[model samples]
Target: MRRLAYIRALLLVGLLLAQSRPAAAQTNLIRNPGFEAPYSAWGGIGPIQVAHEWTPWWSEQPDHNPPWYRPEWKPAEAQFFPNRVLSGERAQQWFTFHASHYAGMYQQVFNVVPGVRYQFSVYAQVWSSVEDDPYPSVLPANPRLQIGIDPTGNWNAFSGDIVWSGEAPMNAVIDQWGYMVVEATAQNNVITVFMKTSPDFANKHNDTYWDNANLIVAGQAPPPTNTPAPPTPIPSDTPVPPPTAVPSDTPVPPPTAVPSDTPVPPPTNTPAPATATLPPTATLPPTNTPIPPTETPEPTATEPPPTETPAPTNTATATATVEVILETIEPTEGPTALPAATEVVAADSGGSGAVAEPGEATGNPPAAVEEADSTAASSTILVVLVGGLALVLTVVVLLLVWRRITGAG
Candidate 1:
């Protein structure tokens, strides 16, 4: 009877142990979570193959293509590495060789209870370098590693319904492992888990390794660990101080008045000396010099009154001779008879008597008449010159006046 009791007790304890175990250990919805299976070329995409239960995905946008698309260009490569495994004999690795890619893998998990919460986690590490330097002394190895769960069971990696976790810390030490976790409530009976990374640089050794992914039922949520502590309370017996009074409005001092004892000098009002208005400067008109009139010699009986000289038949020659006579005549205060008067008459008579007539005519009435005639001619020429000068002066004055009017306008 005691042996029977002992057996029953052992069975009861074993059932309790099974029931108390963590949900993660009891059920993991992920398949091939450790990546123990060999990666095969199943998908048509080249240069990288996926492990079992994972579908390879990448951004199809042209901008997301590899930086260099050479025939030998491989944006990413994935394979199973036995030496780098965290637990099992083999682990999965995805890397680039002087190239970068925005790609990852996903798996759809089904048979989940609707409205139940689920947690997805994965252990990942990165070894990003440049020029064979493990840490890339200059450039940062910003391989942003993260994991996500799409509660809607969507295959699209960029679906908005996906809940992503914070980036897994980059392992400064190679092969060092870190885990990223994200939780989501099941919207339906199916969910999708994703493992993704985007290395900022296309270095020579931008490598990442992932293993031990998990998705398990999350039971009752744990209490928040970061709840703020209640503020300290004042003691009941402590005395309270009244707040000091503050004026609602400050008073402004009035401006000081000038002292009556201080005298200010009065402004001098002496009128400016009246500007002397000198009469406008007198401007006298140009004076016209009076020319003495030629005296007419009275005709005496000894010489009958000289006959009026006939007009020369060749008027042009006569006029030219008269002009020559005027040019040769010297300036004098009064009209003086020119000796060349007979030559002038001779030239007007076609120059035939230019020399003979002056000698033939002695101190006779004809000579005196000729002298008188010469004087008359000089007077007429003087009058004409004075009139011409006046005309020129009038034209100059008009031009100056016109210029002044235009300038003022």
Candidate 2:
């Protein structure tokens, strides 16, 4: 019975130890908050807003009229409340939202939540100067225009929820900037934006327009836009430097470019210095790319291994301590309230009805168990020693009798 109990205890201890572990370690991705400065890869017809940390405070759609720059919008455009202009030492535009100008959210990103409804919104008053003169503005005959969204998302429309209204003689108020915000929730998130007009400034030269928008969820701000995972790193076609003394007859292609800081050529007879080869990445090269050395110039120098590479000479080591984030168990909402560390203690103690996570094993001492094991070990030693001594004595006595009998009994 004791042996069976001991075996069961050992098995329980093993099971408890195996069950204690923290979270499986999930990967978390946080959006790059615009606060520290936003970045735009695309914002306009010619990608004008690429350099702009953000769009919206400015215009997203350009005037696509006779010349055909900006295209048709889904929503209608009936007025230009004041206008927007690029300010600051180095920006093309900065939105003003003082007593004079105010309207719309700054920027927007989207999300595909599993089981939640969603919608989008936008509103702004913007204008741009051409060479320092106010562009011409045209007014249509009809005054009462309906503001709703177009099914197609090509242009901004006056459809959906009416943000504001100006029934004629109010002047399409270009100077007095007003505000507008749309609110909607769809069963399925199929977001579409637009700008429609029976006839207004449906012409050209309207540079500073309004198109900053954001999706909203349950009255809360929208989530960040989900971008596809970047591709894996792999070697690609590295632009080679132009070769000097074009082979006898071959035409040398115009200077193709290379990344900056390539290895310098070696002296006529000397070896080249070690150069560094960059890792392949999906990120775009610097705005200004550098050129490589014209020729091999006598195998100047072998490139150095990438900085991220671990050297063979470096000692292999896991000695550096790792910080284990222990998982805290919340108390059960049921009748019983369990302590945060109780699970850890029970798991380590090999107790029942207790669960533990990795790195959360309690260091509670097991003095009684230790002393019991020690006593059992000591008893086993004494039994073996006594048995061996008795056997030795018996052997000696038998040997003596045999000797006597053989001699001459």
Candidate 3:
């Protein structure tokens, strides 16, 4: 009977042990879940950096090194003062010194049953500081912790179909571990699980540590809800009234008068004339006319013989005659042949003599000899003025012609 009792006890113990063991279907689908693998074992095929079965990922949007093996991925071994490992001899850790990062790691699991729901979870912690000084009080913003599952097994970290967990709650204690979990329905035979942390600020030490990533099959997903469309509103029988029109003659308030200390001038009673008026007989103030000094006749200057008169040429004949008259002027009382030089009878014209008697030359009275002299001087002055004006007019015409030719070119 004692042997029978021992057999029964053995059976009972076996049953208890069997019940305590986890089912084979519930085994972890991740490799190196605790990141206990040696650094030499960590490698990748191409651009990717693999930590055993997990691959590092980072947003290229921020300036960062390619998602390759970096010093930050070195395993965190336990130290004397503060321990980083949560379960085994080593844990996965990444940090930025005097910088910030949005980075994480993901593992893809295959052979998942489509339409089955699964849960992804991880334990994460952060230590954000300013210039190596821990926060005196609570941390201003703890590094955001999240775990996600992509049912479609997409490699993209920001895929729209990813199911993400709420931000893991942080505690006042520095380097305190927090739990994060997310669930999703598998749409294919493969799915991916991720562990991520985004530092709020580029602190001196923005560090994050992760360990014990886990994936497990949840129960079948719930049925999708079918919400009915909202009913459209029925039209009302009453018509909306048109806006009232403003009356054209509506009285507008007058502009406010601004007060000023300066006095305004009164309007003048006299009307402004249409055109400026002048005096009935406008008399200009008399201007002084300078009298020319009389030229004394040179007694020694002899009149040239009539034959000395140059024959009229096409060019400068009038000019030569005027010059001769100016040079050979003698006193009218003297029997000088001055009149011969003054009269320029063209050689080509049918004229008998170039000289003439003084009375017949200018048809002036002998008593008015000084007056004749004055008249001759006036005529010479007038001729010089006219010649100067003609020269100016010719120069202006030549300049205008030159400008037009250049403009056309």
Tell me the spans in candidate 3 whose CA falls farther than 4 Å from its real position: 1-25, 40-50, 62-71, 79-82, 131-140, 172-174, 219-409
TM-score of each: 0.48, 0.24, 0.44
lDDT of 2 by residue, 1-409 (tens): 9999999999999988888854343211112221122324233332223233222211222122111111211121223322331111121222211001111112222333434433333223333222224533222122111122222221222223222222212133232222323333332323333222222222222222333333445345344334222122111112122112112221112121121112221121122122222233433354224323435433233322322232311311211111111111122132122233344346556666545444444345354335444555565566555555555655565555455444432
- Candidate 3 Cα deviation (angstroms), residue 245: 54
Each candidate's lDDT (Cα)? Answer: 0.55, 0.29, 0.54
Model 2 stretches with alpha carbons more than 4 Å out? 1-47, 50-68, 71-109, 112-119, 128-173, 189-204, 211-214, 218-409
* Ranking of all predicted structures according to lDDT, beginning with the best and ending with the worst: 1, 3, 2
- For model 3, give the 10-residue run with minimal summed lDDT: 257-266
Off by over 4 Å in 1: 1-24, 44-46, 64-84, 134-138, 169-175, 219-337, 340-409
Candidate that would win on TM-score: 1
Error of 3 at 299 (Å): 86
Residue 34, candidate 1: alpha-carbon lDDT? 75
Write one digit per residue (lDDT tens) for candidate 3, span 138-203.
333456667778889986676666777666555622466665656788999999887666655445
The sequence of per-residue lDDT tens digits that candidate 1 reaches over residues 1-409 is: 9999999999999999999986543567788887766667433434455677777654322233223111111212223444345666556677655555455678999999899888876667676654465443334356777677888898776666777766555543244566566788889899999877666545555577776777887654322222222122111111122112221212111121111112211111111122222222222222222222223323332132221221222233434554555555534433234345555554555544436443465334376456667677777778557655655665565566555544543
Q: Which of the predicted structures, 1 or 2, would earn the higher TM-score when compared with the native? A: 1
Q: What are the clash counts of all predictions, listed in order?
A: 0, 44, 0
**Residue 332, model 2, lDDT:** 19
Best prediction by lDDT: 1
